[model samples]
Target: MIAANARIGVARSAYFPSLILTGNGGVEAATLADLFKWSSRAFLLGPLAGTALTVPIFDGGRRKGNLERANAIYEEDVALYRQKVLTAFREVEDNLSELRILRDQIKTQGEAVDASSKAQRISSVQYREGAINYLDVIDAQRTVLAAQRAAVQLAGAQAIATVNLVRALGGGWGNATSPDESTQSDKDALTP
Candidate 1:
């Protein structure tokens, strides 16, 4: 954007007077002695030197077009930067929301697993006392197993959400370094 602004300045300057100074220097190489002795005097005696002052007489709106183009480029760059920032913010928000939902899911799933395990234990006791059939105990065992499996899967998903949140935040907290706190090696790693 700064470069684009500088280009705009250059484009605007096209409408102003331009002062151009030009000169050429050459050694008089008629002979080796003349080349060594007359080199200093050759530029003043043999070359043309001049200064030109030029104003934009007529260029058919070229300067105006260039200025407009430069301004457009700068605006485009600013819009692109804004879009990138907005995308980054949206990603962070999404990760945060996912993490929150997964946390609630894991918590509820843990409670469900606990409840199912308790139910299975009670069904086993009933079967042992001959008050319920073995099939009832088996059903309770299957329910407990399914609940435990779901809890484990929810935990896995929670872990995944945590990793994604770290990624959305631009990496793990351990990877961040403030300028004043950074080590020499860290600075060297960032130099490129």
Candidate 2:
């Protein structure tokens, strides 16, 4: 966008007058001995230093085309920038939603693990007292293990969601403010 804007400015400036300046200096020595001689030294200034103002006339629509192209490029860049910003916001929202849902799932899985652990303990006690078969104890233990594994998986998912959320935000959670906070600020600014 900046480059396009600069090109547009340059194209527009082509309509104004331009000033040019030129100068040259040299030495005319017959021999190397006279190279440093003041009389042998020759210089020319101001003879070619006069400013020439060139006012642009008609240009077969070249400048107009350039300006139009630059404007189009700038507009395209602005649109792409807006799209990228929206994509970033969408990713952040997605990650936040995942984190919310995963947290709830983790809590529920944790409760299941606790319940399964209690059931396993009761089954073991019953087996030792001959109130149940050994297979019941084994089954209860397997259920407890499955529940614990599920809880672990949910915790892992929550951690992954947190990482994704941080990545979407472009930095650590501690160093950045939430989008919700920014939205609140925007609302406050809009309030009378």
Candidate 3:
């Protein structure tokens, strides 16, 4: 938006006057010996300094075309930027949803791990009292290990979702402004 405005400004400036400066200075001599003699040397200086004002009268619509092109490019960039912002928002929402679901799974998995641990303890006690075979205790321990592994996996998934959410939110936990507000602020910053 700002770039387009600046291009328009430059195009308008073509109608204004520009200041220019010029200068020339040199020395002339008939021979090298005479060049070293101040009386024999002819020097020219401060005789060509002058200023001119230049004004553009016409450009065959070239300036108008350039301004239009710049405006078109600015519009295209704004559209692309808005699309990127929307995509980011969508990703943030998706990751948040995943984190919520994974948290629930982790809670349930924790309960499963606790139950498996208690069952394994009971199985060991029964085996020591000769109420159950060693195989029963070993099976109980396997169940506990599986449950714990599942809980760990769920925790890992939750962490990944959190990281994704942070990335989608531009590496921060703060809420983002609406797209309109963001666009306005960006334009304000870009403007001269």
Candidate 4:
């Protein structure tokens, strides 16, 4: 800004005062003030502020689509859980029934084994005394072997049923929020 009392001497010649002098200190000051004001208010010139214009996207349709997808997944997870629970109950029921049937079969096999053992003992004695042929002894031995095999098979079936029951009931308890957890959002992100 020019000061009224400030020197305005001309340097065009050794001695010359023909040049006119004028003070523009107030004019310079007003011009600077206007520049500052315009710069300060430039931010309010648009629909959204400058920072808001560049803000991360949050489209309404996109958000709605995401919510719909999440809801579908949550329903599906619930359905899966229901199915698993039903299957587990069915497995337990099936095992109980199978175990009961196998127990009956085992009792019958035990009686057969006992009867075969007695028959073989009698056949052995008769053979030794020459009352029965060796064929009787062979047949008795075969019957005992068959009875033992039957008992073993029944025991195996019982064990298999028990294992299946255990597997059907989820091995252990668990905890977690599935697709139904808090709203699906990018709220944790810095840009959000």
Candidate 5:
């Protein structure tokens, strides 16, 4: 808003016409008769001459129209800036949503990983006791590996979302020594 007001002030300046002052003086070494003849032309023939004021009397509203156009452009720019800010905020919100969902997915995947590992261990014991074949043990191992991979992928997605959130929020969090400043853990999350 302050910026918009400043732009309006700049546009308003155009209403103030430019002031021009001119003065001319020179000795012509004229005789009395020549002075009378020159004086008939106007005051310029005198020893000293000057225009007290010189300004545009009329421009057919061109200057006013230019100022109006400038104001319109400024308003357009302000609207564009507002739209950009809104888009940025929306992006931040979306990233935050993704992060929240990913956090839950990671937690669920972790549990799946743990359960798969336990199944694999049980299958191994069964194989040793001749209750299950080696193929069953291998299948259990594969399941555990798949679950672990899914958890890792979810974690990676969370990190990417965190980075996106930070970028959407304009990157700067707070002063370096501020309590709410980004910590090493936050920096670590942003790292690839």
Candidate 6:
């Protein structure tokens, strides 16, 4: 699958690592759906689960999705905890994996960025000595700009990877301050 590799991207390879986090939205939605299923399952298979705890927040008096009274509380928070822990572990693992990939991508990009910088500098010196024309400066500037963009994108990737790890760690989402928030932002942007 495109997601398994994180490199089968829609954009250029230089930008794909950072863009991979966008894929996390899809992963999160599905995971949340599953968590909701298991969390609410306590009410469904009450006879088997045992005694369900009264989670006041999710099961309020609102007419929402399907769910009835707490039937048999699955006296095993361990089951729910197991589900949460494993899911969290997967998310964190994937995010960390992405971070490693992006880190490598950044290294290559950094080499490019450094080369571009040197080229630009050399071009500037040549232009100053009148060995080249204004066009030379323009080309150097363009290359530098492209390399800088790649670096910015990689920085964004590192940011996204950090946020994914935090989200898996069960932190809240927020603006730029948190990974969960940045993830929501990406998903929101992808939405209407």
Model 1 CA deviation exceeding 4 Å by range: 29-32, 36-50, 172-192
lDDT of 6 by residue, 1-192 (tens): 223223222222322222111111111234655754533342223334333333234435432221111111222343666788898889989998999999999999999999999999999999999999999899999999999998999999899889878878878645335778779889999998
Q: Taking the candidates one at a time, how many backbone clashes does each contain?
A: 0, 0, 0, 0, 0, 10
Give the alpha carbon lDDT tens digit for every residue of 1-192 in model 4: 122112112111212223333322211224655755534333232333222323324455654565555556666666777898888799889988998999999999999999999999999999999999999999999999999999999999998887777767655325534554423433334354
Q: Any idea what lDDT model 3 has?
A: 0.84
Give all candidates' CA lDDT scores.
0.84, 0.86, 0.84, 0.68, 0.79, 0.67
Give the winner by lDDT. Answer: 2
State the lDDT of candidate 5 residue by residue for 71-160, as single tens digits.
Answer: 787888889989999999899889989998998899899999999999999999999999989999999999999999989889889988
The residue-level lDDT of candidate 1 at 12 comes to 88
Error of 5 at 132 (Å): 0.5
Ranking by lDDT: 2, 1, 3, 5, 4, 6
TM-score for each candidate, following the candidate numbering: 0.73, 0.78, 0.64, 0.56, 0.69, 0.47
Please report the TM-score between candidate 4 and the true structure.
0.56
Better of 2 and 6 by TM-score: 2
Candidate order (TM-score): 2, 1, 5, 3, 4, 6
C-alpha positional error of residue 174 in candidate 3 after TM-score superposition, expressed in Å: 18
Residue pairs whose backbone atoms clash in candidate 2? none
> Candidate 1 at 150: error in angstroms?
2.0
lDDT of 2 by residue, 48-104 (tens): 555577887898988888888888888998899899999999999999899889988
Model 2 Cα shift for residue 3 (angstroms): 2.7
lDDT of candidate 3 at residue 137, scale 0 to 100:
96
